[model samples]
Target: MQFENSREFARQLDKEDKLSKYRNEFILPKVNGKDVIYFVGNSLGLQPKTAQRYVDEIMKDWAELAVEGHFYAEKSWWDYHERFSEKLARVVGANPAEVTVMNTLTVNLHLLMVSFYRPSGKRYKIICEEKAFPSDQYMISSQVRFHGYDPKDAIVEIKKRDGENNFRTEDVLAKIEEVGEECALVLIGGVNYYTGQVFDMATITKAGHDAGAFVGWDLAHAAGNIELKLSEWNVDFAAWCSYKYMNSGPGNASGCFINKKYHNKKDIPRFEGWWGHNKERRFLMEPEFQPEPTADAWQISNAPILAMAPYLASLEMFDEVGMPALIEKRNKIVAYLEYVLHEIDKDVESSFEIITPADQDKRGTQLSVFLHGEGKELFRYLMDQGVITDWREPNVIRLAPAPFYCSFEDMYEFGQILKEGILNKQKV
Candidate 1:
């Protein structure tokens, strides 16, 4: 599909998009009654129409049932959390019993770390990428320090090649090999938030398993953006939030996956709460803390049913448009964005660098573009102009065009604004 400019290409792609109608299903943010091209779904997705209704039903349940909502409600609110499990499991490619919906991203990360990051006297180290989300860094450091281990000795962060912005798989495996004997776990984000690098999960999991380390993925970025085969890849555990690509609203409830391999094990050890006690006898007021034989054993407390309603709505939308279709749309949209951005003249080469990988297989919907000059100025300009995007530290702007609601035209608009911003900045 050759085209003279990005707008034409976008129009052509939209004309052929099978899920094009899904765009009108979202309540996109508007500027002066016009929908600003939204290219930040990687940070916060556009709201789905069904989301409000979903939450509203729960609100009605809360009003009608009050305290009785737990035991007796229209859908049995006590077990509402279970209503979401099968869909969450299928999305991550894990058995239903191996997955459960739970708390926020960082909370789930900490819970999983408690069960997975058990370091011995000699093998007391954890491996993660350099510049991981600050929360992950803090969690790892605090966990290491709490376990009476030195943070310097207990944490290994893989870096990119001397001047590169991404890590090489070979370099990563070599680092794993070097620390294998002393490594307790390897925790990696399935897709790096800053570089938008979709990692080779199968190979990484294989290497980590061979090294006798527990492997887990923080799929906060990769959850709905990519096709995950966590179980097939033999990934031991995984966690993700629903607010990003899942369109579950801000700070939606999170989900977890524990490989079924550990499901029937009694001594595998987890942080237990009464809500995780065997379902049949949960309300007996007994002192026993017997846990269910599945990932439900990892539940710390009853999930926020109200908070989870929007996620349920979003998951249903996912089921409507299967992952394969969404991935197809996302791949084209991002590639189009990259192509158009790269087409900008080289006169402003010093003004920015696209930190995301050139290959589609290596990225999701988000592209992290580093402004060589003043990143904040460009970011502010785009925001004030009503283009909603996100910014990370130093000087990088992230634009994630989610497949469910974001159109190719949005990408084209973003490209034009970005180029004009660069050109305008150069004049000053």
Candidate 2:
């Protein structure tokens, strides 16, 4: 498909878009009184218009029923987290019983590691991507330290080849094999936050398993932005935050997946609490902990209803539209966005280099561009002109056109704005 950098071309594409109407569902932010081109959904999603109503309903229930709201509300506070099980399972490609909503992303990962990261004497090493999100780095290192292992010796990081920005699948699989018997776990972010590279999760999971290691993914960017088959892939466990592509509010509750084979195992070592105990006899105040026969077994506390309300509101939309439709639009818009960036690069004095993989299968909505011969002023210029993008260190800006709210017009307009910013800076 040939993409043009004209407003009419963009508007025409928008006119033909089947998912265009869904943009109205979000409450977009304004810059200088106009809706900003929101490309930061990779970092923080826009608020769904219905998010307010979701929270309001919970607030009303609490005011009217007090403690009884846990059982009597329309969507009872006690069972509020259960509402996400089915819908979220569909998002991550898992069975309803294999998925559950719980604490924040890193917190959930830590809890899952407590069960999955059992380090025996000789097999205590963990393999992960180099420069994983800082939170993940902290979590893995701390987990190793807690088990009385030195991070330097216990953690193996897969490196990108020299002069390469993204990791290769063969290299990742080879590293897993090299670690072999020493590897106890293979944990990586399904989608790299910095370069927007989508790792080959299924192949990696298989390789990790073959090497006698448990495999898991931190699906922070992958959960809603791309297709995933966690259950079919035979992932041991996984966790994802709802804020980014999921369109839940900032720092909302997280969703988790635990393979069904591990569900009812009495010997599974996990920190238990009343919330994870059998719900049928939860209030009986039994002294012994009886784990639920589902992913809820990992849950340590009762639902955070206020934080979860916005997430449920967003998941309802995902259930309605489904992931196939979302991915369809995502592929088109991201491709068009890449085209626009190149077209603008041809016209401007500045050279733009997209660090993300050109292969559609290896990238998602984000396009991380390295802006050569440009400085922070270009980033400031973009932000000042109603373009909400994420700027990393140096001169790269991460533009993630979330398919739910972004339009082709936004892409074209961004290109024009970018050209003007460059030309204006050259004049100075």
Candidate 3:
């Protein structure tokens, strides 16, 4: 698909887009009097228009039924989390029984680590990508410390080759083999947050399992952005937040995946609560903790219906469009975005360089641009000009052209704004 660096070409693409209708479903942020060209779905997705209705339904039930809402509401509060299993399972490619909605991403990571990150004798090291999101770095370090091991010895980081922005799959596999029997776990973000590189999860998972270690992913950026096959890949566990690509509201309930093999195992260590008790006997409240024979067994508390309502609202859209259709549109949009950026670089002789993978298969909707100079100033200019994107430390600006709400026109407009920002800096 040859892309032209013109507004007319972008408008033509938008006119031909099958998913163009979805753009209207979200409420875009306003700048001055116009809807801003938003390109930060990797940070926080725009709000779906139906989110309010979903929240209001829950609120109305609470107002009318009070304490009885647990049993009497239209959607019972007693089993609210159950509603997400089918949709989330489809999104992550797992059995419905293997997935469950629950606590936030990092919390789920910790809980899962308790059950899967068991180390003994000399087999205690964990392998993860270097410069993983700060929260994951902190979580892994703390978990290692909690297990009475110094992080320096227990954590093995897979760093990118010098001058490369992403890790090579072969290097990662080799690292797993190097750790061998000492590797207790292999955990990595499915889509790296900074460089927008999508890891080869299947190959990584296979290497970890062959090394006799559990494999898991933090799909915080990958869940709704790319196709995943957690169960088929034989991943032991995975977790993701709903607020980013899933387009759920901020700090919303997250989703987790546990292999079906682990679902029926009673001996597995976990932090449990009443909600994970067998539903048939939950009301009995007996002393014995008989866990649910599914991924729900990992739950440590009751569902927060209010926090979950917006997720349901967004899931409905995903269900309607399906991942296949979404991915189809996403690929084209990202290609166009890349084309526009290249065009800008040529036109302005700008120092901008895309740090994301050149191969479409190795990336998602995000394109992280490394601005060689004046990056912070250009980012601020883009923001002031109503081109919404995210800026990371040093010099990168991340732009995610989300398929659901972002249009080809938005990408073109962003390219124009970015060019202007660069040229304006040169004049100054």
Query: Whole-model Cα lDDT per candidate?
Result: 0.85, 0.94, 0.93
Give the per-residue lDDT digits (tens) of candidate 1, residues 327-366: 8988888888777777764546554579998888899888
lDDT per residue as tens, model 2, 97-187: 9999988999999999999999997999999999999999999999999999999999999999999999999999999999999999999
In candidate 2, list every pair of residues with a backbone clash.
none
Candidate 3 residue pairs in clash (backbone atoms < 3 Å): none
Over 4 Å off, model 2: none
Give the lowest summed-lDDT range of ten residues in model 2. Answer: 265-274
Q: What is the C-alpha RMSD of each candidate to the true structure, in Å?
A: 1.8, 0.7, 0.8
Top candidate (lDDT)? 2
Candidate 1 backbone clash number = 1
What range of 10 consecutive residues in model 1 has the weakest lDDT sum? 343-352
Better of 1 and 3 by lDDT: 3
From the highest TM-score down, the ranking of the candidates is 2, 3, 1
- lDDT of model 3 at position 202: 94
